[model samples]
Target: MSEANIDIQLLDDVMNKTVVSVEESKEKIFEIAENAHKENNFITLELETLRNEIDLVITQTDELEWKAKQARQRLANISRGFKRYSELEIREAYEMASQMQIQLSLSRDKEKHLRERRDELERRHRNILNTIEKSENLISQMGIVLNYLQGDLRKVGIALESAHHHQLLGIQIIQAQEEERKRVARDIHDGPAQSMANVALRSEIVEKMLNQNRIDEAKVELRLLKELTRASLVDVRKIIFDLRPMALDDLGLTPTLRKYLEEYEKRHHIETKLTLLSPERRLQSSIEVAVFRLIQESLNNTAKHANAKQVEVKLEFKPNKVLFMVADNGIGFEKQAKGERPQFGIMGMQERVKLLQGTMKIESKPGKGTILFFGIPLRIEENTKAGGSEK
Candidate 1:
């Protein structure tokens, strides 16, 4: 062949190889993007599921805690009645206390296991999120390269953009998860752990009193120990409930909110009222949880920052949506002031509403109290079944 013909043949061969390589790269990038998306979604679901499990375990711990208190109270009463009561009664009290102690041990073990599982799931979630970010970055780079090639690379660019958006969302979710985990850890350390330490000290006091042959004093000390145990159990249950309320699952939203509000009022001495304009109907589990957490966080803020005494929570069901409003008669801050921006709690609530494809509004002034309104779209199918059972 002539030299010119040979040059043309060589050019054609090079072009063919380049085309093949580009096709292969495109395929690989698409595969990675698909897999990363799937993995990220799976991780998100798994994290949510893990959270639910943790909530259930915490609730069980709370019940066991209450049972422990009852046992302690019985034991204390029996000790008081020993001088005037039957041997059978005393024996029964001891048996009850022993059973309660065993139950308490099992509950603590379950809680520990749940915490470990939460940590593991959190770590896995973080790793998957990081992987998604890297995968998106690689896809973006591939998109840039594909732009220089011939024929229909726009789809790859779109895919790259979509992946980037998902990666950002994943990052946001991970940040929220981390914040929640930190909050829970702080609560456990400050509330339950401290209370437990106090209980231990009280128990030691009772032991020393008995050792000194002070039966009457030891009885008094034991009474004190019983009270301390009850209080500690309450603290632990509050911590656990704050993490997740089983009532949200068992009693649906309205009853759960009522119970929480009642408890909140009793705890903070803040007069609270819950008004339900909508018929008692169940919502999607995710929606129920989000609404519950939103209200919980809002009330917590009210209790902590709001100097007001009365809080009102309202739930309304519309034809195609559900609306939640938490109005607190507190010293509301300036919603528009640059120095008075929304805090993490408010932002977290907003994030949750957004996840449900909802809109949230906060209305507050310096002294007019604060009112938060958020509306979430609801599908007709979501109102299908009620939750498990009433708490």
Candidate 2:
């Protein structure tokens, strides 16, 4: 085999081993969570039984106290009238009082023991619940890792092969892709996953409340759960829009940009204006997506690092090219080597424009706002001409 083939084979072997290791770990965690859940259920039932036993013991003790009081009174009366009562009567009365007192003491002790057991069980149940939650979260994270390895990360080999001449750029792209995946995973876990878990728990609570005939409380819980579901839906939709705005395909670029900027201004509390120098028209899908991303990234930078109060965007469509500009009145900094978090956005924007065979320019300085401009060549539609090409 050639050296490249050998290298590819080695990468495959390494990935397979890594995946196996992760899968094994995930299985172990799942097993642990299941066991913990079972243990919690058992503890719950035990606690219920213990509480009932304690209640019974309390009733018995209360009755014993009354009987012991009567026995004491009878013994005292017999003792006071020693000449009128037989010795057997007095002795019997005294014994009865002593026995009643002993029974009361024993009953009270039983109640105490049952209560302690109930408390212990409750503590164990809570700990088991926490364990189950942690184990479940770990399992979910491992699944994300497995998906990344088996799905998108697999593209690394193809990227390396295709960009052999640009190894560093390929690696940077891979890193960016990995970071994006991590971010998406984090957002899902924190937003939708947590909301769904709460929804499940709340639904269970509502069911229990209704079963117990707590109509008012169940209504309140149901309302809260509905709100949570709504919030989760909104979060899910926002994440989807971030990934790819469907409106870009349906309504074209101008409406999409206008809607996006208006929402952005509302969300970030920044002023934004959009001016179209030429009438809106559909470009190629690739160009549309690229341009949208460029604007999106610029606005994100402005929000995160620019501390901008107002931003303006301009778009101009010509016969053979499109022009775009974003100017922000924010705190800008001196440009230097790109190695920081703030610089990563700019770097990504530049790479995106480069992929579209476009030119991008950035002008910024300390105490000055930032302005970004782009000129992207438009490609003729294949259906429009037999030899359609980029202009």
By TM-score, who's the top model here? 2
For each predicted model, how many residue pairs clash, with residues at least 3 apart or on different chains?
0, 0
Global fold similarity of model 2 (TM-score): 0.55
Stretches of candidate 2 exceeding 4 Å from the true structure: 1-163, 166-176, 204-215, 305-307, 318-321, 333-344, 365-367, 377-391
- The per-model lDDT (C-alpha) reads 0.75, 0.82
Model 2 per-residue lDDT tens digits across residues 64-123: 999999999998888788899988888898899999999999998888888888888888
Model 2 lDDT-worst window of ten: 382-391
Worst 10 residues of 1 by lDDT: 148-157
Q: Estimate TM-scores for all models.
A: 0.53, 0.55
Candidate 1 residue 193 Cα shift, in angstroms, is 0.9
Residue-level lDDT tens digits of model 1 in 187-296 = 77567655665565556657866889889988987787787778778878887888788988888889999888888888899999988886867778878888888888
